[model samples]
Target: MNQYLNHLHVLRLLVQRELSSRYKGTIIGILWLFLQPLIMVIVYSFVFSVIMKVRIPGMDSSYHFALYLMAAMMPFFAFQEALISASNSLFANSSLLHKSTLPAILLPLVPMLATVITETIALVIIVIAAYLLLDQVSYYLLLLPFLVLIRLCLSLALGYVLAIMSVFVQDLRQALGLILTVILFITPIFYPVDMIPTELIPVNNLNPLYHLLDAYRAIIIRAELPGIGLLYMAGFSILLLCASVYFFQKTIERAKEFI
Candidate 1:
């Protein structure tokens, strides 16, 4: 218990440093945390709603579409950022790792916690936007924290594994970039799920991210509880997180040698 507390203390310090350095010397500093996602939401709303003439069925306003996009994009952005940052955590902190006795797990954990802070800001913007645009936010929004917890678990599980492997495979960073792009398009963040082809529904359903974003839309847009599939995915993510920790502990010794 004392060891875990010590690790958590170390993690808190690392996360604080990571977040502070991210926007250091910038004029806006932490305001960029709120502005960054807000700008992305506005750009996406303009591109899809104005330039492309895209519209969500049964919803007349472009603002409504933006709300939908915000709900999905905020979480997806956090997941993507966490994975990419965590994947490089060891390499980026290689000098510190070599000189300190800190547990290597704390390196990847810093990014995960930092991503969560930014994500929380994005989520607050989503709530305020929904209340203003939609005229009322859902009571279901109360469940959002639980949903975010599931996403955190999923990110950490994948991140730890990727972080360790990335020490050995330099090309993984590029590969993950391309793969995340493909995933962003395929995951239905911009379009309604019904817009997907009928034949592909089963395959898309198999994607855990599809379920996660779907749950976000359900809570934010539809004012409904997430489906059973989300509950199942939550369970799976927790188990996967436990497994990834064991995997990281076992492989980190070898990974440190390479680093």
Candidate 2:
């Protein structure tokens, strides 16, 4: 517990430094963090709903299709940002790794925590706007925190593993970008799970991310509790978290030598 608290202290400082350094000389400064995602949501909403006329099955509520997708997309944005940022974090902060006596293992953790903090602030604004626009709220709203935690765990797990690997394999950083692009499409971010063919249901069920996104839509759009899939998401999160910690510790010493 003492070690964890010490790590948390280091994490907080890293997050603060990142937030400030990110926009140190910019005119808009921190506002850009909130603005960029909001703008992307608007543009994507137009292209997917207005131009392409894609439909989100099982979500028949009067809430605008854009908002429905946006709610689900926000968490995914955080997940992807944390992943990509963490992949390069060690390399980006290599100076600190070489010069500082702090736990080198914690360097990758910095980006994950930084992105989590920024995304939490953005999520609050998105949720309030969604409630006002849709004019509806459900008890299932209570599940939002659990869902966010699942995502956070998933991000940290994958981020830790990838961060260590990237130091040894430089090409992994570029490859991860391409892989994440493919993952977003197949993860049900743009469409509902039911819209997927029935035969694919069994296969899609294996994807933990599908369950997470489905759980989000269920609460916001379906107004019902997340069904069996929530359990699957929780189990998968635990499994990933454990696996990442094992991998990180096993390779952590080697990571320092490589960096």
Candidate 3:
């Protein structure tokens, strides 16, 4: 427990440093936190609902398509930001890695936690606006914590593994960015899974992220129970966590030399 607390202390310092460096000379500064996602929601709303005219049938709630999109987007943005940030985390903090003797595993976690914390605050405002605009909040809203937990676990697991590999191969960051972009669209963030062709359903369902967002959609927009598949999602997250930590611990010693 003491060691865990020490890691938390180290994580806090790293988070503070990253936030400062990220917005150091910017004029608007942290305002970007709210603006970036808001802007994305707007752009996506325009492209998907307006231009593309994609239709989601089950979302007959008072919440419009925009609200539905934003609901799913909160976690997706967090996942994407955390994954990308975590991938480059070690490389970004090379100075700290070389000069400091803190737990090396905590390096990737700093950005993952920072992104999750900042995004969670932003999600609160978005959720309130969504509920107010749509109608009374649904009971499924309670599942939010579970959804967020799943996202964090998945991001951290993937981030830790990537961060360790990045020290050896700098180009992995670029490759990961491209892969994540493809995964984002492939995931049901902008569209509903039901719209997917029946034959292709299996392929799309293969992405664990699909089930994660579906769980949120069930509780928030649909006002229904999270499907039994959430157990599968939880299992997937646990497996990833085990694999990532194992790889990170084994490879971190070599990462120290490369950094």
Candidate 4:
């Protein structure tokens, strides 16, 4: 009980430090967090809606592209940013490997928790804008908190494994950039899953990120419950989380020597 209490106290401080330091000394301050998503949304809207003249079937409006992109991009930006930061967490704090008294798992989790909080705040602005611009809001928006929780779990699970691996294979940093780029294009963030060939459905479903991005769209845009796939995603993430910790623990002794 005492150890659990101490862990909570330390995690609280670490999250605070991570959040504050993240935006510190920036010219735009916290607005910096929203900037990247904002730019992506604009670029996608212009290229897809304006140039390509693409139309999402159920959505009929001048701003449908913006709405479509916003719904999918919100959680995705959070997932991508959080995962990247969390994956690099161990390396960023390599010096603290032997020196820190707190649990090492807390290292990746700090960025995960910090990104959740920051993105939640930034998301509110995007949601409000979409509601105003489209004049369409669903009661299903109420379920978004639950969906966001699932996204957080999935991000943390993949992040911990990568964070540990990156310590041994420094090449992961460069390779991760290319991999995430391919994932972005393949994950249906800029397009709809219905466009995917029927043969590809199973492969796409296996991505886990596909489930998350699709769930966000389903709840916010489609205004429906996330499919049963989310249950599978939640299960996979928990198992992955367990395995990652075991792997990290077994390898941690050797990892410290390298660091």
CA lDDT of every candidate: 0.87, 0.79, 0.78, 0.78
Candidate 3 deviant stretches above 4 angstroms: 1-4, 38-55, 58-63
Indicate which candidate wins on TM-score. Answer: 1
Question: What TM-score would candidate 3 get against the native?
Answer: 0.87
Return the TM-score for each candidate structure: 0.94, 0.88, 0.87, 0.89
Give a tens-digit lDDT track for model 2, residues 151-253.
Answer: 8888988998898989899899989988988888988876666678999889888888888877877777667788797797788888988999889889877
How well is each residue in 177-232 modelled by candidate 4, as lDDT tens digits? 78887888999887788989999998998888888777777766666788988789
Q: What is the alpha-carbon lDDT for the whole of candidate 4?
A: 0.78
| Model 1 score (lDDT) | 0.87
| Most accurate candidate by lDDT | 1
True-vs-predicted CA distance for residue 227, candidate 2, Å = 2.1
Candidate 4: the clashing residue pairs are none
Candidates 1 and 4 compared by TM-score, better number: 1
Clashes (backbone N, CA, C under 3 Å), per candidate, total 0, 0, 0, 0
